[model samples]
Target: MFDGMVKIVLAGPVGAGKTTTLRSLSDDEPVSTEMPLTDGPMGEKTTTTVALDFSTVMLDDGTPLQMFGLPGQDHFAHMRPIILQGALGVIVLLAADQPDILTMCSEWLDAIQSITPDTPIAIGITRSDQARDFRMDALRALLAERKTTLPVFTIDARDREQAQQLVRALVYSFA
Candidate 1:
């Protein structure tokens, strides 16, 4: 929402790949706020983002995209508004392997929209390849139920091209 910088936030629950996506998409190593998981681990994750992960990348047109990846746990939610204050868009990443992913996705959307209702958002369902019988239609149906349509993609958050697509789609969604 600023004049020259394009700020976007990547958000999701634990193990949703927000950090990995940031690292994958950034040319330079992201400034990560990871710490040992004294709390119980989610999946194979041994650490969690206590605050946020940050990086800046130049888009194809050379626009500077200042990306902030939010911590997945609810406890760190207080940081959301700080990261989102002037964000142009948000890319919510959901891990397909998570139980009740539909509900989680909906919650993330609600949380983001509650703060920045007009911000363009794109959804990326990560780790679909690791989930058996993951039905993307369910997510689509959930969005439909919300009476909204958003760009959604099943992506590997570890892949650069796929992560960049989510970013590009978020920017172009409002263009």
Candidate 2:
């Protein structure tokens, strides 16, 4: 039933693995960073996603996904409204180890809610394998307090299959 292209934005805080997630799902090698950082919290990292990064993939029903990833920084927050203009949904990446993740999720939820209240939003808790596994109930409760009713799961960004499955779950929910 997904005929026309679906634009999906991946939003999260810095080091939440937004870039890595974009790299994993696309058919291609998932294009590299576009713009360079002049002066930002990102500092002078060799790899910095300044503007927005994009990649695409076909759904099982032949629908095209115009996957767009936004730089996970307050400086880049301005781009969300524009990038989310026609987005079908969003994949919000969150690194549990980072204490600021809850704040990041809250901010993004507020931003995206204004654009599309019904827009499907899924949270991916990255780096679960690195840190002690947190309770899924606690994670769900956190999201519930923000008024976001969506599935939240732990994910390893490095594993292509696991990452793809998480995305697939989100897509399937839309159906």
Give candidate 1's TM-score. Answer: 0.92
What's the CA error at residue 118 for candidate 1, in Å?
Answer: 0.6
User: Model 1 Cα displacement at 155 (Å)?
Assistant: 0.7
TM-score of each: 0.92, 0.82
CA-lDDT, candidates in order: 0.89, 0.76
lDDT of 1 at 32: 96
Model 2 accuracy (lDDT, Cα): 0.76
Q: Summing lDDT over every window of 10 consecutive residues in candidate 1, give the lowest-scoring window.
A: 1-10
- Cand. 2 TM to true fold: 0.82
Report the lDDT tens digits of candidate 1 across residue range 11-130: 999888999999998989999999988966755889999989999987677678889999998988899988888898899999888888999998999999999999999999888986
Error of 1 at 103 (Å): 1.0
